[model samples]
Every structure is written in structure tokens, then in C-alpha cells.
Target: MDISIVLNLHDEAEYVSKTLESLEQAMVYAVKRGVQIELIVVIDNEKDDIGTIVEQFNFSVPSKIIKVKNCSLGPSRNDGISLARGEFVAVADGDDLVSANYFYDSFVFIKKLEKNKDRVIVFPEYVMHFDRFCFITKFVDSDQFSAEDFAYFNPYP
Candidate 1:
């Protein structure tokens, strides 16, 4: 597989469907661009309807749902990543929605970095925050920020 999207779910029954739908669109877009993709959803809460929600979604790529008991986001994400078979891995939250071109755009950027590819991390250039308040934040390239800047503020949303 070229890319594996690991999505962490924790009691996000209200948003999981939309998130999965958005991810499916992204997967389809990437696949059309010749990027093989798979999805791994890690549910940290067994008591919620997240699993059922995920099962109802029609994913375009190979997908799996792993159940865990309250391990929180960090460990749940790690669990999903551990099972990923992709050459490149992308992380997502069950409540979030990404652009349809997200994976394809990232793939194009990664292909540009032919040397030291393993040392690079890809992040979206812009993030749209919603719900209570709405705002759009732009992220610069990693080299533009110093270590101290990261310590004081989060460059990536």
C-alpha cells in the first residue's frame, strides 16, 4: 500500500460518519492519482456507537476497525499505526474532515523530496477550525520555525 490513514475514534458518534465520508473522498482522489490507500480506524471506546457508525460507512479502500478499551488518543493511534501496511502513514481524528485532495497533494509534495524522504513529516498547509468558533490557520514549512518556537507554540493544528 502507498498510504495508510490511521484514524483515532473516541466517543465521536456524532461526527464519525462525516469524517469517514471525507476520508473516503480523499482516498478515492489519491487512488485516481495512482496512490494506493488503506484505512485503519482505532476505536478507544467500546461502549459507544463508533464501531457501528464506521461499519455503516462505505469506504473506497481497504479498511479495518480495531477496538480498544479507553486507551485514549495516543495509544489508540499507535495501535492503528502498528497494523498499517503502507509505505507512508497519515494520522487523523474521527471527528475531523480533510479536503478531498489532501492525500494526493501530500503525495505530490513527498515525491518532490526525493532525498532524505524518511526524515520528512508532511502537514497540511491550512487548517479550518470550527464548531464554537471558526478560524483558518496557515502552517509554514518546518524549516521556517525554530525549536524554541515549537516549544512555545504549536505550529501544526
Candidate 2:
């Protein structure tokens, strides 16, 4: 597999369906571009209906569901990442929705960096925040920031 998306969830039953739909669209776009993709869903809350929502959704790529009692996002993400079989792995939240071109565009960018691809990390150029606050922010490329910049703030989220 070329990419494995690890989606971590904790009591996000209300939003899992939309998230899955967005992911499926992105997966289809990536597959059409000849990028192999897989999805790994980690459910940290067994009391919720997130698992049922995931099971009912149709995915275009190979997908796996992992139920865990970790209760913490960090460990839940770790569990999903551990099962990833792709050359590249992406971490996603159950309540987040990504653009349909996210995966395809990312793979195109990675292919351009023929030599240092392994050392690079790709982040969305624009992040749209909603619900509590509504705004969109454009992130600076890695080369645009210095090491000292990280000491003050994080450029990647």
C-alpha cells in the first residue's frame, strides 16, 4: 500500500458518518490517481456507536477497524499506526473532514521530492476551522520557518 490513514475516534458517533464519507471521497480520488490507500479506524470508546457507523459505511480502499479501551487520543492513534501497512501513514480525527483531493495532491507533492521524501512531512496548506470558531488559516511550508520558530509556536497541527 502507498498510504494508510489512521482515524482515531473517541465518542464521536455524531460525526463519524460525515468523516467517513469525506474520507471515502478522498480515497476514491487518490485511487484514480494511481495511489494505493488503506484506512485504519481506531475506536477508543466502546460505549458509543462509532463502530456501527463505520461498519455501515462503504470504503473504496482496504479498511480495518480496531476497538480499544485506551480512552486517550495519543495511544489510540498509536494503536492504529502500529497496524498500518503502507509506505506512508496519515493521522486523522473522526470528526474531521478532508478535501477530496487531499490524498491525491499529497502523493503528487511527495513524488516530487525524489530523494528526501522519507524525511519530509506533508501538511494541508489551508485549515478551515468551524463549529466554535469559523476561520481559515494557511500554513507556511517547512522551509519557510526556522528551528527557533517552533520554540514559539507549532506550525503543524
Candidate 3:
């Protein structure tokens, strides 16, 4: 497979559907380009009704639901990654909405970088949505920092 999308969900039943829909939109683009993808949702709440809703979505790729109880984000994500069968794994939060081009664009980019052994590419823009508004933040000329840079540079600052 080309990519495996791991979505970590808690009790955000109301928002999971929207997130899934956004993914479906991205999947449309990916399908056109013939990029293989899978959806892995690691949910902590079995009774949250999100599973029932997820079952309704006819995802082109295979999907898996891992049910756990009171799991932390790190462990849940780790579990999802462990189960991933794709060459690349993309992580998404259950309540967040992704752009329509996210999967397709990333798949293309990954194909180019697949020649290299290890690398991390960060996108320049991200949209932050609040209760009343949303803002798009773009990082111009962002450079890839190394482990040594992390020791000296305060990224948040």
C-alpha cells in the first residue's frame, strides 16, 4: 500500500464523521491517481457510536477499528502505527478536518522522497479553527531542523 492514515479518536463522536468526510474527499483525489491507502481508526470508546457511523462510510480502502479503554494519545497512536501496513503512515486527529488535497499531495511528495532512507517533510500552511473563527498560518522558508538544533533552538519561541 502507499499510505496508511491512522486517526486517533476519543469521545469526539460528534466530530469524527466530519473528519472522516474530509478524508473521503482526499481519498477521491488519491483514488484518481491510483495511490493505495488505508484508514486505521484507534478509538478508546467502544460505546461512543462512532464505530456505527464509521461502518456506514464506504471507504475505498480497507479500514480497521482498534478498541481500547482509557488509552493515552501516545499509546493509541503507537498502536495504530504498529498496525499500519503501508509504506507511509499519516496521523490525523479525529476532530480535525484535513484539506481535500492532503492525501493526494502527500502521496505524490512521498513518492519522490521514497528514494531517500529517512526524512520528514513539513507542509508550509496549516489551518487552525476556533469556535468562532479560523486562521491559516503559513511558514515561509521553513528549514528542516536536526536533533542538535532542537537542543539549542526553542521552536515555539
Q: Give per-model TM-scores.
A: 0.91, 0.90, 0.81
> How well does model 3 score by local distance difference test?
0.79
How well is each residue in 32-93 modelled by candidate 1, as lDDT tens digits? 98999999989896657778888888888999998987567888889999999998899999
Tens digit of lDDT per residue, candidate 3, span 1-157? 8888998988778888888989888877887889888889888755578878877778877889888775688988998999999988988887888788888888777677866854766452655654566565544433565557668875432
lDDT by candidate, in order shown: 0.87, 0.87, 0.79
**Candidate 2 regions off by >4 Å?**
116-118
In candidate 1, stretches whose alpha carbon ends up further than 4 angstroms from where it belongs are 116-118
Question: lDDT (0-100) at residue 120 of candidate 2?
Answer: 77
Pairwise TM-score winner, candidates 2 and 3: 2
In order of lDDT, best first, we have 2, 1, 3
Question: Native-vs-model 2 lDDT?
Answer: 0.87
- Cα deviation of 60 in candidate 2 (Å)? 1.9
Candidate 2 pairs with clashing backbones = none
Collision count for each candidate, in order = 0, 0, 0
Ranking under TM-score, best-scoring first? 1, 2, 3
Cα-based RMSD of candidate 1: 1.7
